[model samples]
Target: MSNEHITTGQAPKPVGLYPHARRVGNLLFLSGVGPRVAGSGPNDSAVPGLVLDHNGNFKEFDFEAQVHSVFQNVKAILEASGSKWENLVDVTVFLVNMKRDFHTFNRIYAAYFKDNQPCRTTVEVNALPTPIAIELKCIAVIE
Candidate 1:
């Protein structure tokens, strides 16, 4: 098995120290993704109104839209690696307010995962970048 780093223009480029995703053998390791659009922060052209809360407060979080953006980022990386959601083998979700938004999270999550439920673990975290409620990272095996 060879190690390959996958890059895609469709998704937001990682900021600090990570690749979008990496492939080792038949398995792909995707990094945690937040609701960030390309060239939108500390990078190139800024995306106005992309920030959920202007004051850096968690109370004004846009949960649904953030979740959707996370999945869209995931989709872009997965497709770039020649894989899809159906190939997902495992997923781990991190939430800043799990108790408050578990139901809404489930509903949004179900739309993407569907009946092909991969092994998953969800955890409540104290905080996340931009104070967003949710962040997701997954692993998939390409057949």
Candidate 2:
């Protein structure tokens, strides 16, 4: 089978020059999906996951809310590819502050992946392209 590039309006339009996800054979690879809201157009500013300061550090960050938005965006991309959360096989998460936020993120992650939990690796990064504290890049398989 040939590769299929996927895009969806339900999630925020990608800021970079890439599709939301791509399929090669039965496996699908997703781009790093952030916690931005789907803006009206490509150039419109996506609503950030939570409040932030000039330095892009959290002033009053809501980890749960940010996690929820990121997961929702991931869900949208999966649905667009004829898959769902259950089909997710792996995920790589980026967190701006692992020491401060990992526990909350892990709790929320547990709620989302109550079963069929995919293998995950979370890392602390200096920053994300957006002001959010979390992002997810995932992989799934479609029948």
TM-scores across all candidates? 0.84, 0.89
Per-residue lDDT over 45-106 for candidate 1, one digit per residue giving the tens place of the 0 to 100 score? 22222453455443344678777887887888899898997898998999888888788989
Clashing pairs in model 2, backbone N/Cα/C closer than 3 A? none
lDDT of each: 0.76, 0.84
Best candidate, TM-score: 2
Q: List the residue pairs that clash in candidate 1.
A: none
Residue ranges of candidate 1 with Cα displaced over 4 Å? 42-54, 58-60
TM-score computed on alpha carbons, candidate 1: 0.84
Identify the candidate with maximal lDDT.
2
Q: After superposition, how far is residue 120 of candidate 1 from its true place, in Å?
A: 0.8
lDDT of 2 by residue, 43-126 (tens): 443545466677756567677777888888899999989988899999999999999999999888898899888999999999
